[model samples]
Target: MIFQHSLYHIRWAEDKQILELVWKPTTQDLVAEEFQAALHNFAGFGATYGVSSMLQDMRDFMDYLPPELLRWRDIVVSPRYRQFGLQKMAFLYPPEMAPKNMGNAPIQIRGYAEEFFDVYESATDWLLTDIRPRKAG
Candidate 1:
């Protein structure tokens, strides 16, 4: 019962009890495609009332993510961009160097500040406990 899926969309890795999400928002095709998959997963897992945020590695888009990307509102909150506003606790980890109030994306309005994590595994460990995605043995 290993739920294996690889996409920017959310993945229910039942065996691992982990939901894997990766976003390639730089390109329209990747953004739209990943969002489609993520939305479907969100529907299956419940989307209406969960507070999800972006796991944005801001460094990936350092040069122009602000001017070019933030100019669009939908891009700020689009599923293609990040699976956010889902009402379930989500996370955001800006690059170590990005200033505390750096992101220019409109989602910053969510007011969910980023907490530094030493590593992804550590972050996910905390999320799994907090979110309590069903674990598989």
Candidate 2:
């Protein structure tokens, strides 16, 4: 199954039991509202399907996240995903955009296991691992 919004596309990997969200490229930088909308969609989809693993494709995403929104992401967004049983997240970022410290960003603050990959195959393989979801207390 697939869901589409202006900022991103969400698809369910039935065989792999993971939800994949790919950000769409835009000429303008992304705003917090757009990013939040994508998160809301993720929350809704994960809740509805009870999916615990996610693969985020950021290859085509060129927007810069503002500092304030970055804080909200770590403080508010990450926790929400944890509440919805998000256990593992694989981030596929292009090599150019994937800085050395990129994995240390707000996206990794949820306390769930996460890894960054430059290739889709690696990310998908990792997400397909048999690791069970760890519920947040």
Candidate 3:
């Protein structure tokens, strides 16, 4: 099960629990509207399979979340995603970005366990591991 969009490719792995999203690089930065649309597509894809794990390949993506979008994401978008049953997300980032981008995980992903990795294989491997229940803070 695969879906392709202008901004990303979404695949529902045969492994059942995981849904993978590989973002495409853009020549220019994405505007807030475009980013919201892409995020909507992502949520819709995950809802289709009731997936528990997500592997996000962001190596080709270079845009950062602008302040407004970041606020909207944390305040609005992320809470809705939490209702969709997604428990974990593994982000595959470029090696050069591993250091700087890792700290942003908690801010970008809410109500889930997320980690950044420099390689796709390792990210996927981590997504497949036993997920312990996270206690509410």
Candidate 4:
């Protein structure tokens, strides 16, 4: 494990070159500041370890953030991931949270690939594979 907080814990999967973040269930609501802090910490790990693949196990995550916070993640936090060479990010959610597309549609990140999954094994498997298209120079 690299970093651990009350809300989440970050783990380094050396063999797969992936960084995993497991979110813990919270009794109270999650604020944007707290969420950003956690993500900053995750980015710190990525910068330190040169992580390319990321897996977020959000099965225990139950809090909801506002649209602004979500937009903040896309505009601010995501570039940090790309800056540090992050290639693929897989979000592992519970079956109940599965999108209507059934994880078929990918989130649009200019330099990176993001996918949603309901299974841990599938998330990790996709992370380890290089099936996504490469960015042009």
Best by lDDT: 4
Each candidate structure's count of clashing pairs:
6, 0, 0, 0
- Give the higher-TM-score candidate: 1 or 4: 4
Residue 15 alpha-carbon offset, candidate 4, angstroms: 2.0
Query: What lDDT does the true structure give each of the candidates?
Result: 0.38, 0.77, 0.74, 0.83
TM-score of each: 0.36, 0.82, 0.81, 0.89
TM-score order of candidates, top first: 4, 2, 3, 1
RMSD of 3: 3.4
Top-scoring candidate (TM-score): 4
Work out candidate 4's RMSD over C-alphas.
3.0
Query: In candidate 3, what are the lDDT values of residues 23-134, reduced to their tens digit?
Result: 8887157677877877777778787778778887888986887788878876876675678887787878898877564634332237778778897777777778765534
Models sorted by lDDT, best on top: 4, 2, 3, 1
Residues 49-78, candidate 4: write the lDDT tens digits: 998899888899888767988888888888
Model 2 poorest 10 in a row by lDDT: 101-110
Worst 10 residues of 4 by lDDT: 101-110
Give residue 90's error in model 2 in angstroms: 0.9
| lDDT tens readout by residue for model 2, 1-137 | 47977678899999888898889887157777888888778777887888788888989887877788778877877877788888788889998777575434223447677778888987888777755433433
Model 3 scores a C-alpha lDDT of 0.74
What does candidate 2 score on TM? Answer: 0.82
lDDT per residue (tens digit) for residues 31-107 in model 1: 44344444455444534323353233222222333444343433444442234343222344445654453222122
User: What is the lDDT, from 0 to 100, of the residue 8 in candidate 3?
Assistant: 77
lDDT accuracy of residue 102 in candidate 4: 47
